[model samples]
Target chain A: MATRAPKTKRGTARRETLLRSAERVIGEKGFAAASIADITRDCGAALGTFYIYFTSKEDVFRELVGMMGSLTRRMMTEAVQDAPNRLEAERLGLRAFLAFVAERPSLYRIVEEARFVDPDAYRAYFTGFASAYATHLEKAVAKGDIRPGDAEVRAWALMGMAKSLGDRFVMAAEKPDLDRVTDEAFAMIRDGLAPGGAA
Target chain B: MATRAPKTKRGTARRETLLRSAERVIGEKGFAAASIADITRDCGAALGTFYIYFTSKEDVFRELVGMMGSLTRRMMTEAVQDAPNRLEAERLGLRAFLAFVAERPSLYRIVEEARFVDPDAYRAYFTGFASAYATHLEKAVAKGDIRPGDAEVRAWALMGMAKSLGDRFVMAAEKPDLDRVTDEAFAMIRDGLAPGGAA
Candidate 1:
């Protein structure tokens, strides 16, 4: 006879527990060094249990990427929707991104490691987010709020800048003032790329 | 007493051979995975001779970063100096950067792996290059050739963009149209940041 499945709530709780444990292990030991036994032991689960939820470490990594991406998108969407204008939306987006990275430095390492684990997965994760941001940028450009240009490229460039800045500042062992860096970066973007003279 | 230096140039040549061999091995198998025996064997040199010039595998990695940095700076300097105008200079600099990366994808991996091997070394390597580029950018900004802003931050942003672009195109196993991407990136920078739509 076939075995019964676990209750939905219990399965999700176990999954969340395992994911948290995996993140910590991967963060401390790196993706390559962290083993299934280590993650299961940390999560207080059995080795077989990990296989039930994640086929391998790579699956857990992909899930991490998806989870972070979804969280980031949700936060950014909320912030953008709250903004009254394009410039405000841009500022809000930058702040939200920095804030997210500052809160979860390990996530940065996970994302960085993903590039090596699977380039295709990395491209998919990045392109998905870039497309979402580009949609917002296109609206701003259409409204004459920002300069007319390739919104997709601009979105990627902006995201790249933010990621670089965060990697340098927020993820540093000795963190800097995120608020200051965010303001400085946003000012550069606004004054550097705005349609008119030095917005 | 310290052993007298070899009178013949053979010692220096042997050292160079070992360094190159180490680079190749590390490039293929990663720094952590590449054994000293593998490197020495690749060079057809005695394993003991490897220790004569370098303290350890990590020392070889240190030297690799320095070599790559100097090579990059030289190529970028030449490219920029040869260009007649700011836009041309930007294009030349980018083209140089991409070409250098395309020719040595292994060096790219080594530099990134340095973060895991030695964080301080990684910071020093990046700071050295960033400062060099920033100085060049500052000079251009002083002459009103480029946009008015924090030249250092702008330099970092530009470098970051190039790095992200390179990771996507040049370092991929399946290389993209690097020349076209370089041109497009330079064009975007010029048009997006030029003083008066001159680009």
Candidate 2:
């Protein structure tokens, strides 16, 4: 976590700017090469001012990773809220995730980098996501919105599919045909959730 | 590539030792924290002799990533060679991948670290794997063993699923249950490959 949260609206904006700068600097140069001075320089703040918000570079990085985790979950929930069934939610959620990656490439890079820089945060990010996702899968199964299967296994598999698709189509591709990617993935996911699917 | 492939049999053994040593050092300490001297020390090779085989640490690291990519493909192909059909191959492949990860955790770490240390090598590794996987998917579709679909898209999606499962079940879990993970993942893939599937 950050050392402290800003007490005023202006301070909040300043802190936010520093975070945005960290994303750009760290994402581009990577965690090893990125430094607090570089982050402050990019944000047009005095280097000493960084110590006012973040205790260290590691602190800001953990905060960034944590922030991304919350943002991802919230965005996904909002994206699927209008779906009438779990199958539809799967489609909407995959689409939302791909779109989110397109809009925020740094989020993908940061989470990945966290794997090396901050191991605990990295594990927490995915484990937390998989836990919630598994619960959702179990509920869908009980509601008959999907086939009965190993919720934990399916959650991890489904999440893996989305993460890989995002890496390929969104992060790597020049003109990401997200529609096609989602449709193909959704087709496979939808079948796996069908009643006759070997639950 | 290494600085040079040893022509003499004894020299070849020495080079292989250094390469293995590098994997241990890099995998344990990570790319940034790991030094070339530490790698040589592990292999009991003279620090200066390290350069006789590899120009630099980065060169050796890239070679290692490339080696892992080939080894992974070769191992997976061998694992599925006897499958009666595509469905059986999916089961065998996932099982093989998870088992390989459990046995060689370094492979997972190296490929992942390649993302930051050697981005191009990282891209090529997965891209190459996906291309070969897509070809296999296309052949299966043509043989009527699986439903027709976008082979490339499905290849990446399925690869992602296996990769994630490997990370969670094999890399992270204390004692991974490879059999159950394969069974659950295969069930989903089989259903998703059925004729009625969207393909």
Give TM-scores of chain A for all candidates: 0.90, 0.94
Off by over 4 Å in 2: A192-199, B192-199
Candidate 1 per-residue C-alpha lDDT over A116-135 given as tens digits, one digit per residue, 9 for 90 to 100:
66556677878898888779
User: Chain B TM-score for each model?
Assistant: 0.89, 0.94
lDDT of 1 by residue, B7-66 (tens): 569887887788789878987787667999999999788889888878788888888877
Predicted structure with the largest lDDT when compared to the true one: 2
Q: How good is the docking of model 1, by CAPRI class?
A: acceptable
Residue pairs clashing, model 1: none
Enumerate residue pairs that collide in model 2: none
Determine the TM-score of chain B of model 1.
0.89
